[model samples]
Target: MTGTPGTRTGRVRVLIVDDEPALTEVLSVAVTEAGWHPYPAADGQSALRVARGCAPHAVVLDGMLPDLDGIQVLRRLRYENPELPVLMLTARDALEYRIDGLANGADDYVTKPFSLEEVVLRLRGLLRRSGAERTRADDPVRVLGPLVLTARTREVHRDGAPVTLTAKEFDLLSLLMEHPRQVLSKAQILDHVWSSSFDGGGNLVEVYISSLRRKLDRGRAPMIHTVRGLGYAIRPVEDGR
Candidate 1:
């Protein structure tokens, strides 16, 4: 299950970390069924070793490990690959744990009594996002309403005024504007904007959307609209439809 990055050529390498052998087997089966290559590790140290050697695109990490706590393992993984998308699976059902996981750079979190289907979906979303970002790297510019994004220059302007954004913020805005008026599901936004390798469970997406609204729609008619239970969309707000 271990191979050089890109050596396999058509599938994404995913590191599945869990101390439970049965669960690990089930997850490996699911991952394989979903067309991803799964590399399983039974402990934190082994997880890091596998990750470093193979360079997986994403990781499915269990919260409790025999050697190192899941969070600590995640920290070490992040250090090795800062941008690696990690999904935390834990038996702990606490708000603080989820918050702490997200703060420490986990892209997604799932409780132990979770759906295998959901994990598959999340992983697919992450891969698609990462692929789309790579394919769309050369797309130069996109404009929506009065907002404009120039990918080559890495610049943004709203209503003819310069607007500064962090690199990630700009990428998020670019994705939204690229498909104006279309209601992008949280998964879609997460995949396209955040590189699909990380989910962060919509919180990261929400935070970025809020920041975009504040900076890009200030004193304006509000182009960013939350679609209530769906996701977010960016388009001109009609004056009095």
Candidate 2:
């Protein structure tokens, strides 16, 4: 899953730099699975060149590079993009080795032979803490089965038919569509879709949900379902499992 060099609009960008092709591929795959684009570079020069254009939201930098040292690369990266989140991958687990990477500029350090999932989680945590995801460009249009929603336009379509909605309706539908097949509780929906100072009860969510159901399921099988007293979830019409 190699990505072209440069910043990707409306997508979270992750740069994976490792001299080993196998390791770089593994990291890139994991990063892609996390729902972000992965840009792979094999050496320090390549990483810097890619970063110059990639403007990566986060970086997974290996401790050893064939050309420049990992710390040196990290230094150059920080110099350019000071706020870029970096997780250094070191083959050595020694205290001094770990300290050196962190002391320079690494936001975090991961030892080699590390769990692939751990590296992804570390990168996610770094992004969250750094507030990068929140500042990312508008979400690209999201598609799920016959349902399609465009964030930039705030428009939703069902079965190729347009559906008009209020501001609140659009927000609620967008949230559900963001996590299709995942149940979101009334409280959760209220917090995300409505204002925090919104004193309205869960009934507000129920009303909006009812409106969405009427608009989306008027002539189709129920795509939105309620899990007893749990919460509401949206799925593709044919995705019954």
Candidate 3:
């Protein structure tokens, strides 16, 4: 985790650094599911680059890297922002490894193959301690790539053009925006947007989703996507694949 002025964008940004591509993506998705922006880097150099641009509130750092070691990265990050919270992830659970990470400035430690839920909870705790936690419900504006929505005004925009949506459509779209990049099952969508577990809720979700796609993606790159049996997710077109 590191900070330099002029990088924050009114959202909690987390930096996830790991040499493994799959692990980095998983961590990024988990952070997004928590309603926070995630910046993923596959190596220490890449991590430093991202931190320079995002001013992340917290970091999930892998203990080993292809280039610099995790402890070295930790030192550089601390030099930039001593208050930034870091959750270390190490494949080696040896006592010395744990002590080294903590002595280097890690706020928390988690061994690899750890529970995703536990990592998220630990990050949340670190954020709370650093005065970086904020309720997503309190943010009236939601942004996903080129799409923007203002909850207070009930306004939706795609590339600066006003988009018209009905009450249910707005509710569903906002729910997706609230958890960008996170796949939401029909059951979850039903409970959150329709406030029901009725048998028809699944069909209702599909119908509204279709309508949203038609209206929001008329002549442009699609943002709303279906994930087959899993349900649906909305992401920038480039990343949807």
Candidate 4:
């Protein structure tokens, strides 16, 4: 697979690791469709080599590798690139497998028989959360009172103090700040932030919102307001009217 510059977004390189050639080929196509370049590897060693060479923004790693187990590979990869987002793909559905993968530093995990569309969305979410996806240099820095967000720098400050956030938290807060006082539905948030259409059967969005409030709203009037049965919004402390 060759790296092609994206028409709309910057080129994002993704390493697809799987022993099955057929799966690798299909994943390469999916990666391309998702507007990313794919670097395919059949074994753990090959995966390491490709990762170092391509400097992929993310990786989809198979759990059961022919050369090394997924956990080992994940640890090795983390050592090489601690911030690189990795999504583990495996047939194992056991709770222990999931726990082990997460413990080893996988950014996300998916079982076999998963939807290709879902996989693409997960990859997109990972990229967004890790600040790997490029944005326009001219994007404006949003400011609502003391809260400040510079999209280009991926920096957020509250009351002139630097506030650190994970990739996902930063994206979620940015979306809310972009549309202050406007209630954004769960579907809208998931679509814009996670890049997924997964039904709101999960509380992932809510969890992130809660953490954002804790971090960004602490020692100040809450800006993140949850509209019951509607969604959430960021607004000034006064003038609920």
For 91-163, candidate 2 gives per-residue lDDT tens digits of: 8899999999898899999897899999988999999998877866654655565566667777776644678
Q: Which candidate is the best by lDDT?
A: 3
Task: Report the lDDT tens digits of candidate 3 across residue range 1-241.
Answer: 2111111235787888998878877888888888778777788987886675455689999999999999999999999999999999988999999999999899999997899999999999999888877543344666666576777788887654678999989999998887877899999999988767577888889899999999999899998888989999888655657
* Lowest lDDT 10-residue stretch of candidate 2: 1-10
Sort by lDDT, best first.
3, 2, 4, 1
In model 4, the worst 10-residue window by lDDT is: 1-10
Q: What is the TM-score of each candidate against the true structure?
A: 0.52, 0.56, 0.55, 0.54
Evaluate residue 141 in candidate 1 and report its C-alpha lDDT on the 0 to 100 scale.
Answer: 47
Q: List lDDT for all candidates, in order.
A: 0.76, 0.81, 0.82, 0.80
Error of 4 at 232 (Å): 58
Candidate 3 to truth, TM = 0.55
Steric clashes per prediction: 4, 0, 0, 1
Residue 126 in model 4: shift from native, Å? 0.5
Is candidate 1 or 4 superior in lDDT?
A: 4
Judged by whole-model lDDT over C-alpha atoms, candidate 2 comes out at: 0.81
Clashes of 1: 4
The segments of candidate 2 whose C-alpha lies over 4 angstroms from its true place after superposition are: 4-8, 138-241
